[model samples]
Target chain A: MDYIRVILTIFWKDILAERRTREILSAMLVFALVVILLFVFAFDLSPETRRNTAAGVIWVTLCFSGTIGLNRTLSVEKDRGGIDGLMLAPADRTALFFGKALTNWVYMLLTALFVVPIYSLFNNTNLFSFTLLGVIMLGTFGYIVTGTLLSSLSLQLRSREMLLPVLLFPVVIPLLLSAIRATSILLEGGSQTELNTWLVLLFSYDLIFLAISVMVFDKIIED
Target chain B: MRNSTKTSLMLIVVDILAASLILTALFMVFYYAPVEVEMGLVQKIFYFHVAAAWTGMLGFLVALAAGIGLLRSGNMKWDIAGVAGVEIGLVFISLSTIMGSIWARPIWNTWWTWDPRLSTALIMMLIYFAYLLLRNGVEEPGRRARFSAVYAIVGFVSVPLTFLSIRLFRTIHPVIIGSSDPAATGVFEMSTRMTHTFMISLVAFSVLFVALFWHRVRLGVKLALFEQRKMEDFTGED
Candidate 1:
């Protein structure tokens, strides 16, 4: 119960901070929008082509934007000594992990929330599909889970900003690949049978990585 | 002193054993192991190639375990061992990847395929190579150990994911080279003589892993001791 409060409190603090400053979200949003625009020009795809490739474009953009958001979010805590205070509090390290992950998830999702409507308007496509949202949610969950833990680990280092991607991208490639493929299938109006295997693969990936992160996270933060 | 003597004696025995094992494995592979209907002579490289990869993974797992042990106990010696294991693992991974490439040239006709195992091996190599770089980037001994330990632990998870990530793209891929059942790969058949040779080679490689690990650990201890002495000298505390 206390752990829940701690997590919520941390989450709220992060939310309030972002609301006041709008640093992370603004950067992420602009970056994502730019990436989408670049994809539009570079690929020169028709509507059908864009729809098919939209999943990949969105995910690649999210991954890049997500990394930026995570770095800024953690940097905020580290810079303001907020994380130190949080650590000093009577909260479990897992709570901190969860709190940060949740906050980052919301930020990422919010970025998506803002991104999708604009994407639909600009591309003149329907990204408002419930299935696409489902893919984004599931995909973002795995990304934030792994990304938050790695950001924490990297925060304690000197070349932290650069180190996070180096440590993360290789490990997280499976998530990106699975999410993109699943999303692409859905966007193409594929039947459930066509998407079933990828959905299972995505869920299993999220579960396996979440479990491993939970097991090792204590060691990571024990300093 | 006594430990060094024993280690040196063990090294001699291990050297002899490894030589005999490699030769016997080679002999059996060429003379006894049946040629594959599909891959022919190139399939022979799979034995040594996969053996190298397996040993590399074994070394990586050991490094991860040692990393956890060091953190739990706060022992620098365990940290030293962890670094040594990762370095040796890096070497073996490189050997395996190169051998895989060599074999791929004749078999896959491209000298490379983005095959899952090969791709994963490449990722493992980069992760650990980055592990070493991360260490070099830090100046503090304590912080270096902590960071490297975390990196090693995190890096191991990628090994499996990299090896299998392609399967999510499609399940048409076969994990024949490292499967538990030989028939699954359908590319190679091992006679009894071949099996004997493989066992010998496995044992030999395991010994080599230990010897190399021990030597690296000794170097780490010596370096640490030297630092300690230099610090003491600087402070004039001795």
Candidate 2:
């Protein structure tokens, strides 16, 4: 009960903060739109090629633009001294970790919400199937889980703005790989076993890293 | 303070062992190992190529273990061990990658393929490069050690998935010395001499890894001591 409250409190605070500014969400959305256009021009997508490349475009756009939001997730808190205040509060720190991850996860999901429809509109392909949306949710969870944890670590470093993606990208490659392949499978109506395997991969990835991040978040947050 | 005792007796022994073992392995690879009927001369590169990949994997494993050590014990020496492991791992992995690329040019008809193994190797290098950069970004020793250990653990978690993902994803890399995949290319059957040469090469590279790892750890110790002294210098007389 207490843990949930602390988490919700932070979540609410972040929501309020983001609502007031909407800076992170707007940046992510605009960047995602540009990436979609860039992909269309770069790949010279035909209807056939568009279906093949849509997964890559959607995932890459979310991956890159979400990075912009993730970089700010922690740095904004630290920059405003909110991190120190939260840490000093007599609340469970792991709860705070969850709250921040939850907020970022929501931001990424929202970004996908916008990007997926817009990508469909631009590419003139339907990408909003139930299974594809599920993949998006699973993939975004894994991505934000990692992005938030790593942003916490990177935020305290020198030249942190430039350092976040370098630190985060390698770690998330497997997730992206699975996500992209799974998206392709969904879009192309690939075999069930193939989809199951990538789903299992994404689920296991989310589980393992989530547990590891929770266990180690203490060490990272301790001043 | 510089290293005392001029040369450690153990280092001299390691140097001699590594040199002799590597030379013998090279001789075995070139002169002893029977050339495969199919890839001919280029097949010889397979020996050192495997050896270098083995050593590279060994280096990252050392870093991973050392990371666990640091997290559990909170010791600076563990950080030194971790740094030494990653630096050596990055260099040898790059070498292995180059060798693989060279082999691919002849065998696979391209200098590179978007194969899982190749991409994984490249990604591993990027992860460790980030590891080194992360360590360099922090001036405080404790924070640097803790953060890098965390990153190492996180980075290593992705490696096996590259292998696992390949099951659903097709690859053209040769399925050498393991379960046969008909889809694989560059297949070879190792004859008796090839087997012996391969074994010796593996052993020799293991020895070389140990020698280089130890040397790096020693240098790391000296650097830490030097840094400590420099820090002490900044404060006029405590």
Candidate 3:
């Protein structure tokens, strides 16, 4: 379908651009590393404390670094007038939203992929579980679904840099709370019963936000 | 001219009613309602605290409706209503949070807890604070209205989620009128007089919310007109 192609075209364009510049990924990765390092010195937790708190630390780092990637994802388009160019393309605007959100979601997952192993090695706690990774993916998807839409809105503002997180963080609290809880439960070796509610919360958040972002993205992008 | 006078007269009547009702509600809270035995006089904060929280939620619902209105009709009046609702919502939510904190200090023995209701209320406040900031960051009125309306629409999705997540996950905050939870530290059974006072206070605050929102919308309309006139003058000079 043309819609699928349009979405993929936008997605591939971002991929190609990032593959050439590597700007967003590099910044997000470095920011993730620094946040983790700062957490190390700030908390100075013992092994037991570290085990319990590792999930919180990782999610927080991902959230902070994820903001960087999101800011870049849209600001880059706005800075170069790429959004106007994309708008000129005869495609549904929702496709553009899906494309951008998908790209941001990928960037977030890639950052997590790198951050998780390094965090595990440094903290001496295994965080590479499938369940935790699943939570990260769902959480990151929900966050980016909202984030990409908000970043687009913020990019049109004078205070785009500061506005994105202010707009995004408060709205994403449900996703964050559920994600953190699920991750903590996995880290503590909790059974499925404890994780079920959180997983449902994350799924519902993703669905709700994805639907809203698609519906409202057109209004924000209008000239 | 006659229509303007009529509208102003209605507003004045509403203002007088709001004032008297608020005074009566305060009297009922202090003099009429039974003093709570467990927490003593400090428990009196619950009357206004709950009232303010309900008003804040009502304001947000108004904002959400106005947001949808703007998107549907593309009218600046709807945008004006949207901003007014958010502004008033922010004020009452902030009041509720602070009063809840003060009440918590004595009852829960801590100034703060990660109680679901309290945390969600704080998050709701932060979302609207961001809404205000988002509006400030735009200079163009039309674009600003569009962006803020869209943000309000998107932002409202969080309210229900925040409430549900808190209710589902864990809560130590008191559920005032519901099934008794033994773990809820602040649960209190209300006598008939107390219930009457609470209902009156809720009604009074709802009227206050409407009055404040109307005034704010009027101010927004005037500001928009003034800005348009200023732009026209600048264009004329050019």
CAPRI band for model 2:
high
Which residue ranges in model 1 land beyond 4 Å of their true spot?
A: A46-48, A191-194, B31-38, B161-186, B227-238
TM-score for each predicted model, relative to the true structure: 0.88, 0.95, 0.97
Better of 1 and 3 by lDDT: 3
Model 2 alpha-carbon drift over 4 Å, by segment = B1-7, B162-169
* Angstrom error at residue B61, model 1: 1.4
- Model 3 chain A worst lDDT run, 10 consecutive residues: A123-132
Q: Cα miss at B31, model 3 (Å)?
A: 1.6
Ranking by DockQ: 3, 2, 1
True contacts kept of each: 0.45, 0.82, 0.82
**DockQ score of each predicted structure, in the order shown:** 0.50, 0.83, 0.83
Clashing residue pairs, candidate 1? none
Best by lDDT: 3
- Model 3, B201-233: lDDT tens per residue? 999999998888878988998999999999999
